[model samples]
Target: MKVVSCLHAAVMVSDLDRSIEFYTGTLGLAQVDRDLNYPGAWYQIGDFQIHLIENANYQASDGIDLTVSTRNPHIALGIQDLEQAQQRLLAANCVVKMSNSGRAALFTQDPDGNAIELTLVDPERESTKKFDII
Candidate 1:
C-alpha cells in the first residue's frame, strides 16, 4: 500500500457559520456542496480540499500561536502573489505575520485559530523541487 497524495485536511471548529464565513469570506474560498450528515464545510483549491468540521466543544492545540512561526504545524498553501494575499488578509482584519527567513511567505489564522501559511509559488521552480525556508 502507498499514500500517493493528501486527500484533504479536516480541522475542528466551534461555530459552523463563523468558520464558513472565515474560510469563504476571508480566504476567498468557495464553499462546495457537501452531503455529509454532520455540520461541516468543504472547500476545494485545485486538487486539494479543506474540510472544516463543526465541534461545539472544540479545543485548540498549543501550536495555535496565530503568529508568524514556521516551527509550528500549519496548513501551507502556495499562491501566485504573496503581497496581494497579505493585503487581502489585512483588509479582512486578520492578523498576518511575514516570514522572517527572507522568503515571500506570510502566516495568518482562521476564526477558530487554525494557522494558515501563504507562500509564493513559482511554477518553474516548484517542478525543480525547490524548497522554502520553512
Candidate 2:
C-alpha cells in the first residue's frame, strides 16, 4: 500500500475539556472540525490536524502509546516566528530551549503528560520547499 498523506493524528487525553483548552486556547490551534460521537475534539494545527480523545475507556495501563524518551512519534509543530512562539509558550508556563542560532523550541506536556515539541521553521528552507503555513 502507498502512503499518500496523513489524515490526522490522535493523542488520547485524560480530560477532554482540558485537552481542548490546551490545544485550542494555549496553543492557538483552530477548531477546524469536531464530532460528538466520542469524547474528543479535533483541532487544526498548521498543515496537519490533531485529535485529542478521552482515554478513560482505554484498557491499557500506559494510557498513551509513547516511549520514555518522548522522541518517538512526537508531534513537532512548526511556527512561523520562533521568538514569538517561544514567548507564547513561556507565557503559558512551558519550558523553552534556545538554540545557538537564536532559534527557540519549547517542550510542553499535555494534560496527559504527552510530550509536544514546537519549533520555528527556517524561512530559507521553507522557501525552497512546499511548506505548509496554515
Candidate 3:
C-alpha cells in the first residue's frame, strides 16, 4: 500500500536517437538495451530507469510557464500492494486507471494533474526480473 521507490521516469521526445545520445553521451547515463518491438530507449540512472519514447504527435510547449502544472511529466513508482494502493487512491477521490495488458499497475494523477504510475512488484521475481526483453 506504499510507494517503495521510483522505478522510472518517462519522457516523450521528438527524436529517439537524439534524446538517447544526449542522455547517454552528455548525461553519462548507461544506455540499457531494450526490446526492439517498441520505439524507445532506456537508460540506467542509478538504480532506476529513464525511458525516452518518440512521440510524433507531440506538440512543443509554447513556453515554460511556472504557473501551469498540468503539463508536467509523469513519474512511475514501485508499489508494495497494488490493490491497497488503488483502494487508497479511490478513497481519496482519485481516478485510478488500470493497465490494459492486465499488468499490476494503477495510473492516477495528482491534484494538479501531474501523472503518476504505481506498479506492483512481483515479490518472487523482483530481484531477478529482466528488463531487456520487455
Candidate 4:
C-alpha cells in the first residue's frame, strides 16, 4: 500500500503566540482554525494543516528540549525551489542549519526549535509548488 496524503502537521510549541506569528504571519500560512481562548492553533500550509499546540509543561530527561531529538525528526516540506525557500527563511529570521550535498535540501527551525526541512525536486522527475494558502 502507498500513503495517500498528509492530513496534518503537529509541533509542540513553547510559546504559542510566537509560533503562530511565525507560521501565520511570517511563513504566510493562513489560519484555518484556532482555539485562541484555548492553547492551540491550526494553520493551512498548502493542502495540509499545521497544528501548533502549547506544550511547555513537558520536561524531558535532558531538561533541554532545544537539541534533544537530533536525528532529523522533522517534516520534510517540498518547495518549488531550494534557493527561494532559503531566501524566505532568511528573511523571516529562521535559524538555518544544514543543506544536502546536492544543494537541493535545507533545514530550518520554528520558534520552538521544531525542525522544518525544505527540499527541491527536479521538475522532470516530480515537482510540487509551495501553495499559497487561501
Name the top lDDT candidate.
Answer: 1
Candidate 2 stretches with Cα past 4 Å from truth are 57-72, 98-104, 122-129, 132-134
Candidate number with the higher lDDT (1 or 2): 1
Which scores higher on lDDT, 3 or 4? Answer: 4
**Which stretches of model 3 miss by more than 4 angstroms?**
65-134
List model 1 lDDT by residue over 22-113, tens digit each: 88987889788999899999999766799999999997776666444687778988887787899899998998988767788888888877
lDDT of 3 by residue, 1-134 (tens): 99878788777776677666545653345888888786888878547897777776654444423233223355665566788878877766766787555667767654333355667765555565433211
Q: Which pairs of residues collide in candidate 4? A: none
The TM-score ranking, best first, is 1, 2, 4, 3
Minimal lDDT window, size 10, model 3: 63-72
- On a 0 to 1 TM-score scale, where does candidate 3 land against the true structure? 0.46
| Residue-by-residue lDDT tens digits, candidate 4, 2-25 | 997988977788787888888877
**Model 3, residue 48: what's the lDDT?**
88
lDDT of each: 0.83, 0.66, 0.62, 0.67
Clashes of each: 0, 1, 0, 0
Error of 4 at 128 (Å): 8.9
**Poorest lDDT segment (10 consecutive residues) of candidate 1:** 125-134
RMSD of 2: 4.9
Better of 2 and 4 by lDDT: 4
